[model samples]
Structures are given as structure tokens and as C-alpha cells.
Target: MTDTNPIPARLAALKTMSGAELKKQWRALFDTEPPLFNRRYIETRLGYRIQELTHGGLKPETVRRLQDLGEQLDGGNIATRRIRTDLKPIIGTRLIREWQGTEHCVTVTRDGFEWQGRPYKSLSAIARTITGTRWNGWVFFGLKHHRRAA
Candidate 1:
């Protein structure tokens, strides 16, 4: 007997396909090599592709709305193309750190930082003011560190 539901049958078959076979299918479907060799990833993406081929994918308006939401979440602005979510401190957050023997506090602002009743453009400037030497403010405040060898 022949199967009627071709898409569902294809999706089911994807679960049992080998990595090389999945990569070949991925290249046919997406015109590119599969990003990884994981079985679950291949199955899930193939299922999605099968569904997309059977029924149309997301609407243009939905795509636009999603892009707009992503931009907003990334601190959307006309001037800045991209904003790093890791380094962006919410306004009114107080960052306290001990430098040398003294405790220094900085309040996060929309534009920059406020420290010791003075406004500074960058945390590194504040670090310089406090330490009297050049320092990475993110490292000084324990926000980031140098990468270690793998």
C-alpha cells in the first residue's frame, strides 16, 4: 500500500536517516550544508522544512513584527546598528566595587555612568579616575575577564 501523507512520511523518515544522508537532504532543502551533525537537530529542521513546504511559512507581516521585536530587545536606535545585551546596564542600576582600599559606586544612566557626583562617558574613564592608571572598566568591575586557553 502507498502512503497518502507524503510530508508526514518524509518527516518520520528523517528521524532514522544517518548524519551524511541528513546533510545531503539539508543541502537539497536549504541549498547549504547542515550546521551540525546532531540527529535531533536534523530531524527537527527537516520536520519544519516539510511542514513549511506543505503549508506556507510565516507571513511577511509576522516576519517584520518579529524583526522589530528583536530590534527593540537589542535596544533599537537609529544611530547604533547593534547593541550588546551583556554590557548594557539598565538605567538606575548601582554598580559598587572596591578599588585599592576604597569602595566606589556608579549609577547606570541612559547615556553613560554617574560616579561620585560626576558624569563619565565610560567605565574605563571612571576606573582611571579611581585607580590613577589605565584599566578595563568591565574587568575592574568584574563584568568581564580575559579568555583562558582551552
Candidate 2:
């Protein structure tokens, strides 16, 4: 019998194809307009799509597990979360904030954080206690700052 697997040939061809060729193949394989990402992104996604079409996509349970893990990683907001593991301060670093003229301090700890001699799982909880309002932990702690539009 002839070589049974078509995946290897199809994937190998991608390395040699031009950007235009990849876009053309993308339409054929994906049945839609190609995304506006760079050529390398297109090639990588195309490679995965090829294998996915041949072997089927990820299992539902696996997809759920990934989402759960992402929730933990994204601090429960995966829909718009960016990679932020690098932003967490080192243990023992004190995060200080001033709310309504009172200086507040939160210490980074082995298990989440500490404020006012009590343990807190997130900066948001401490913020809510301090302000009585829900807030993004990172934003509350001043780890992320957004520029306002004028």
C-alpha cells in the first residue's frame, strides 16, 4: 500500500510555501478568510489545523481542564487576561497604597498576601475591605495601570 499518512507531506510543504501560498492554503483548510497575524503565526496555526483535521480536535474534557487551568492562571478572567505571572512581586515585598488619606500596606507572602495582621487570598479582597468595592487585584495593588483617553 502507498504511504497512508497525508499529514507529514502537508505539514512539510508549509515550510517551503510563500506567505501568499499559505494564505491560499489557509482558505482551503479553514474555509474562511485568513487572520491578519504574521506569516509565522499563520504557518504554526496552519500546522496545528492540519493535524487537528486529521486526528480530530482536542477532547472536551481536555478543553475544560485547560480553561480551568487558565482561570487559575488568569486569576479567574481568561476572556481578556494576558500572561501576568511575571508581574507578581517577590515574597516579602510590601505593596503599599493610600486610600482616603490612610496608608495601607500589604505584604506578599508564601500563600497569597497579608494585610493588617490577617491573611488575604487576593489583593482585591483587601481592596474591597479597604474601600467596600470590587476591584481587580492587580489594579488595586498598582501592578497594572491603564491610561485614560482624553
Candidate 3:
């Protein structure tokens, strides 16, 4: 189960947030929590955060970070659910759509990271696809509790 009190208050604060406040709030929320359980909780909350930002005009950098997080959560396990949920905010939103022109590297983005036929959402996703391993924060967008690879 989730924390009833903290989440509600946090959600309330998010409602009145501006673009500049978003990143800070997000960082604060994630920073306090230890690696409590799996990444599901973190991913879900982040998904909603993305949705909030979408209305404020999702910046390219934010989109890239979200996409990268999605990839990390997409190891085809329970984490995938969280990743998918996080992606919900951008489901219908327009992305830059990266193209790599190669058999691989087809990633989706919203900031024109497309090369060939790939549309990467974040750098981590790109690194994973290119390197073929679970990648954590590569670009360091200041996300809290990013689990380091063992």
C-alpha cells in the first residue's frame, strides 16, 4: 500500500506548482524515500508528475529524462508496469520521434533526438538499446533514488 498522508499533501502541492517548482518538488519527493520497495511506487508517482508537466508545456529535457526512466523500468518485470504507467502522461502527447536509419535504435522522443529511425525518449534508453544492458542515470538529470547497477 501507499502512504496515505504524505502522498495526498504532496499531490496538493503539485496542483499549484509552476514550471520552475516542478523539478524541485519532484526531487524532494524522491529524495526522502529510501529504496523502499521495488521501483513501482517511484515510477507511478513520476508518471503523474510527467502528466502535470505536460500541461505546462513539457520541455525537451524533461521528456528525455522521462523516456530514460521508462527504459530503466522496462526490464520486462513488475517494473514494466510502473514504466508504462509513467508513460501514460505522454501517450497522446507529441514527441520529436528520433530516427536512426539503422535496423536498431528506433526510439521515440519529443526533442528531436531521432537519428536514422530511432526515437529515443531518454539517453538511458538509447544507451541500453545500444549497449544491451540495464542502464541507470547516464546524463544525471538529478533524479533521486536512482538504483545503481549491481
Instruction: Output the number of the TM-score-best candidate.
Output: 2
Candidate 2 structure quality by residue, lDDT tens digits, 1-150 = 799898999999999999889999999999999999998899999999999998999999999999888777656754336534556789899999999999999999866789999998788899999999998877987898856799
Q: Which stretches of candidate 3 lie over 4 Å from their true place?
A: 1-79, 87-115, 119-123, 128-150
Clashing pairs in 1: none
The TM-score, computed over Cα atoms with residue i paired to residue i, of candidate 3 is 0.22
The whole-model lDDT of each prediction reads 0.82, 0.87, 0.50
Across residues 20-139, which tens digit of lDDT does each residue of candidate 3 receive? Answer: 465565576456533444444544566576555545556899999987886665643453444435433343343232325533333334342343566655546664665577665233
* Global Cα RMSD, each model: 6.1, 6.8, 15.4
Candidates ranked by TM-score: 2, 1, 3
Which 10 consecutive residues of model 3 have the lowest summed lDDT? 90-99
Q: What is candidate 2's CA lDDT for residue 45?
A: 95
Looking at candidate 2, what is the lDDT of residue 38?
91
List model 1 lDDT by residue over 1-150, tens digit each.
Answer: 987878877987887888888888988988987896468867898889879978989999999999898777545664334435456688899999986788999998876789999988678999999999998887888778957699
Instruction: TM-score each candidate.
Output: 0.49, 0.53, 0.22
lDDT of 1 at 70: 75
Q: Which whole-number lDDT from 0 to 100 does residue 107 have in model 3?
A: 30
